[model samples]
Target: MHAIEVCNLKKSYTQGENALDSISFHIPQGAIFGFLGPNGSGKTTTVRILNGILSPTQGSALVYGQKVTANSQEIHRLCGVMTETAASYENLTGWENLDFFGQMHGLSKTEIKNQSEQLLYSLDLYESKDKKVKAYSTGMKKRISLARALLHRPKILFLDEPTSGLDPESAQNVTQMVQKLAIEHGVTVFLCTHQLKYAEDICTLYGFIHKGNMLGFGTFQQLLQEKNSTIYLELRGDSIPPSFTPYQNANKIYKIPITGDTDASQILQGILKQGGQVYEAKQIHWGLEDLYFAYQRGVSHEISTKSNDL
Candidate 1:
């Protein structure tokens, strides 16, 4: 079953200002979907629409098969949301902040304490659990927000730039926690961010938006296939045959393009026959960053051409 679905969803704040164009996609249950785009690319707007914080100008969005409009309360109950801005009382301690949200989610006092303790410990915020939120560092505050979001053990987590403002270690911890929730708890995560590299590391699925339009949507491998990404073989320790002349060389590492496993095997055999020592040969594949830029460049060119035509 799909955790979320959007069909021809469009939202406009003004007569002619569209925040999201007609975009359609589905996020599978237990999948960590990275909703990627540049600043003002309508990612956050789409999140708001899905969460029913804003109504769409046209079309519809559903959470777990229920219309977001008709089942707003149920959707909110089933989903945990953490936007870029951390919302908490400045005077409240980290634990207090989470406890408040937990109560709002209808969790019992005992349940709130148990969940808050687990989250604070896992996120390394236990040390400062009693500290006022205003005194917490940016990373610590972000972790507390996350804890609040997860306090009720919602089935879907809608996190907007969750790792933003976090240190490297904290960011990694957040990523792991997200992945674990999706994989182990069967929770679905809709992660909206422009951090392509970090998204590539954790997301199982991907969606790209640009200029308020849906540019692309699929798994990483699916996106790579659509882009027709090449497989590069990096070979070391040369005695390179004339036919085996590498196209790219860096620090004694020769890179060659291979069509498939058979081609790679043939190249290895040929290299060995030519008395080349096979020190290392690994396949290099494009990640989300490469795929994102490739699509963005194409989109930009297309837009420029259309503008010139007009």
Candidate 2:
């Protein structure tokens, strides 16, 4: 089922200016959809429209096939949103903030207690649950906001930079929890993040926006094809076969184009038989980072060519 459907959505604050151009896409249920873009590219505006916090200048967004508007209440109930500025009560303890929001979501006292404890533990805040939020670090605040968002077991999650200030271990916990929510509990996730390496691990689908325009939207393989991406075997060793090319500006690193993992594995075995000390070897992933820049660069070239024509 399509969890969210956005069609010809546009938002403009000035008479002839647009914050969001007419962009359209749909995210399936239980899928982790990566909504990626640079700052001020209308990513936040689109999120606000879908969350019913802002009204669109034209067109609509439907959540679970129910239309969302600035006045809609039902859509808010189904979504768990954690943004960079998700506010918490500074006077309240970490646990208190969760308890307050959980009650607002209509969770009973017992449900709140059980869920809060579990979340606190999972986010590594159990030991400091009683600490006042004012005294907590920036990362702690982010974690608490995340816990509050999930306290009601929301079916749709909108997370912007979920690991903004987290330590490596804490970020991993958020990653695992996000995966668990999508895979085990069937929650649809709309993720906006600058961390491409992190998003590459969990995102099941992707959408790229630039200058308020949605330049690309599809699954991993589809985007790869869109970018005409190629996979290369990256081998690091003191010596390598003459067939491989030295990687750009990197010593002892060689790159050889290959079809897929099977091809890369076959070539690696053949290299091993030649007895060179292979320090590291793996197929270089044409990951989100690569695809993102490729899309941006394509758009830049198109604009440049049009300008030259004009």
What's the TM-score of each model vs. the native?
0.87, 0.83
TM-score, candidate number 1 = 0.87
List the lowest-lDDT window of 10 residues for candidate 2: 301-310
Computed on alpha carbons, the lDDT of every model, listed in order, comes to 0.84, 0.84
* Residue 126 lDDT (model 2): 91
Tell me the deviation in Å of residue 38 in model 2: 1.0
Compute the lDDT of residue 297 as modeled in candidate 2: 70
lDDT of 1 at 290: 69
